[model samples]
Target chain A: MTVAIQLGIIVGYLLLALAIGLVAYRLTDRTAEDFYLASRTVGTIVLLFTTFATLLSAFTFFAGPNVAYEQGPEWVLVMGLMDGIIFAILWYVIGYKQWLLGRQYEYVTLGEMLGDRFASRRLRGLVAGVSLLWLFPYVMLQQVGAGTALQALTEGTVPYAVGAGLITAFMILYVVVAGFRGIAWTDTLQGAFMLVTTWIALVWVLAVVGGPSAASSALEAEAAHHLALGSDFYTVQWMLSTAITIGFGVAMFPQVNQRFFAAGSKKVLKRSFALWPLLCVLLFVPSFLLGAWARGLDVAIPEGENVLPVILAEYTPVWFAALVIAGAMAAMMSSSDSMLLSGSSYFTRDLYRPFVDTDLSARREDLLARIGVVGFATASFLASLWNPATLFELGDAAFSGFAQLALPVMVALYWRKTTRAGITAGILASQVFYLSSLFTSIVPSTYAGWTAGLVGMGLGLVVTVAVSLLTTPAPDERRAIYFDGLEAD
Target chain B: MSRPALWGWIAVAIGLSALTIPWFLWGDATLVAGVPLWLWWHVGWMGLASLVFWLFARRFWGLGIESDSDSSGGSPGSGSRVDAGGERR
Candidate 1:
């Protein structure tokens, strides 16, 4: 019965999303600009919800809460407080700058922007290749989360492969059907689902444990250490590094960076970011509280499984658990859908059209992006079934890898002397150091109280600046590609 | 927003971000109303961040992107129907 209700709610939600996606597609102008960026006219409300949904994925639903449950609630500060402010700042620094350039050049992808500015096909290929590389793990992470959550919610009634495949199939349909227009519409729905259900889940769980005071006392008695700071796990370094990695990394995610171009006007972008920190607070608090409070309850979480489903199933009513789990599925779908959509743009526009066929027509390019969506989603679904690493591990590596690109991209945007070689070298060197953390211990993942990604980001910034100063400027004609029209009023 | 004022707000944002992690309360596990004091600090600090961001939004919404573009690019965000590598008309 529980499985039936869960399946029913989930299937119903998916159908509603599909219908919405199909309807949103009617608004598409069939032009590349309209398809990829919704004609760059997205307003404030939809923009906020889509971005919120896109950013809060399985990590927010499963990994973040699990961290709070097992370790402590200090995970909140890293994600909620630190990342919130940092990302708002980055949305301005990196995103706004990109928005300016994107407006002038009508750029749809970072690869397009960077590659054009430097006048290097290799740089375009490099930027697109790096994004797709890191994005693969993130896509796989979403699939894994979806499959695992469903499996847990239904108590194995729904197989992991089936759950993962279901979302993949649905994503391909909707993403190919509507593009960013469809995506923004469904993301608004999913974002609301996530926020509403997470808050209700917290309240439900907290009520079951009596109340905040009682739960706090229970934690104090059973897990007093969770309430306090000074632990090695939630240390200043761990919190700071994790926050920095995820915060900076987000701006470089193709899906998000693309939204920087999709904003209708600067007002839309400014309003969305201005409200971002508060939104983070709303969703994160309840989600983390569920995990932290679960530690005080009688929830039995087997090793390597997410604590959220277990808490929902054991504590909340069966119907409510099913609803919230569907909400978790909502979070994962919103995230993966955006990933596949933007990844398609990267693959089709940045890689295929540029390298494979410069003369590729817009209609064919659009068709290829649809095909890319199906292909990429299938690969991720298969990888989820394989389930290589834990959620946190995969998520962290992806974050660190993405973080390496942010600084180089920033330099390309703001600095006039930025050379192709300098940006390329910076990205490559930083990623080399970052990737070493996983495969080898020589370059520790965290050193001197900094994450490998944080240190790597710093390293990339330094290399980019130093190399830019050392390299000769691009010729005037080439420089005019980006810098020609800029003068303050 | 003027150049100096924009930079000043950026500095203020930086200051708030630096203090967000509760460096002072690392060892202090004091709970207010059964919630961790540090967590409470985050809640309050977030309100301040929103205010700062809101104020910044109201003042510097333009980020100077509107007035700085070259006239050759047509108009800003017209979705100029050109390829990324194609020349801006």
Candidate 2:
């Protein structure tokens, strides 16, 4: 009986999301900018929520709490505190600059902006390539999470592939029909749902277990290490590297990067970033505390399963657990839909428009972008069925891959001297080093103290600085694109 | 902000980031209200970081991104207008 009502509610919620997409499609203009960027009129609340939803994926819903449940609450250090604040700082340093340039040039995609600056189609393709390569796994991870959540929520009544496929189909439809406008609206809805439902779950769990002190007392008795940050697994080096990697990685996400351009005004952008850390605390504090408290409450989390659904089922009423699990589904779908939109933008703008047909019309381009969404989402769905790595593993790999691009990107934005060759070297060398660490044992994945991703970022920065100083920018390459308000030529 | 002033902010960012890591709290096992001291430290640090960021964002925004003759730069397509310093005019 509980499963049926829970399933019914979840289905209704999914339909509501589709309805929002349909309405967005009705309201949105068919132009490339409107389809991909909402005509750059996204307000502060929508921008904040969309970026927040896009950044917090199945990783937040599943892996984060699971990690805390197993290792300790120290995952909060890596995520809630460190990543939450650092990403906001980078948003100003990188995102604000990107937004300014986006408005000036009317740029809708990261590759379009960077490629235009260098006058290099290859550079555009490279940026698109890097984003797509790392982004697809993340898309797949969302499905993996959705599948895991549904299977757990339904008590294995819904198969994993079916659960994964369902979200993928819905995401493709939402993205193709509504584009950025629809995706952003749904993201706002999903963001609110995730926050509220998660808090309810946390509150219910605490009520059942007798609050924070009780959870803490349980941890002190059985899992004392869970309360502290200096454990072997939560070492300073590991926490910092993880936070650095994820934080910069989120900053470079094509979906999140695209949001920088979508903001309605500078004030909206500024307010969103300023309040970002506080927003993070609202969700993550509950998530980490719930996971930590589950130890005290004697919730037995299954191997390879998320701690969230388990705790929800054990502590909360069945209908409430279903609702919250659906909320987790909300997080996953919100993330996947945004990924599809951005991935399509990367395809149609960077790859299709540039390489395949330079003279394509805006309408034709929009059509192709829709097709691109279908293809990317389908590919991700198929990838989800193949091998099916853990959520944390896939998410971490993608985040690290994206993190490699952060330094060169920031340098390109803030420094007028940054050259195309410099950016190219930075992107290529860093990616190669990071990939080698992943695939081969010839180079240790962790060298000295930092992870391969951070090392790759450092290496990229060095190469970018050295090569940019050594080489001269094109005579026609203008300075105002990057440094407009400055007094310098 | 001047170049040196910008660099000063960068230095401050690094210093604050260094403090956030809690490397020095290796042996501290003190727990307040069932939560470890480190977690509380983070809550405090995050509060400080956000406050500082809010101030920096307010004071130093649009430093080089806004300009009265922004369109005058030789880029193929770009546009903006601004005061002598880069706030809305």
**Candidate 1 stretches greater than 4 Å from native:** A480-489, B1-3, B63-89
lDDT of 1 by residue, A57-83 (tens): 888888888999889998888887546
Question: Candidate 2 docking: what grade?
Answer: acceptable
lDDT for model 2 comes to 0.81
Give one digit per residue, the lDDT tens place, for model 2 in A180-257: 988898889888888888888887877877777877888778877777666777777788888898889888889888
DockQ of 1: 0.30
Alpha carbon RMSD to native, model 1: 4.7
Least lDDT summed over 10 consecutive residues: which range in candidate 2 chain A?
A480-489
DockQ of each candidate's interface versus the true one? 0.30, 0.28
lDDT of each: 0.81, 0.81
Q: Chain A of model 2, TM-score against the native?
A: 0.97
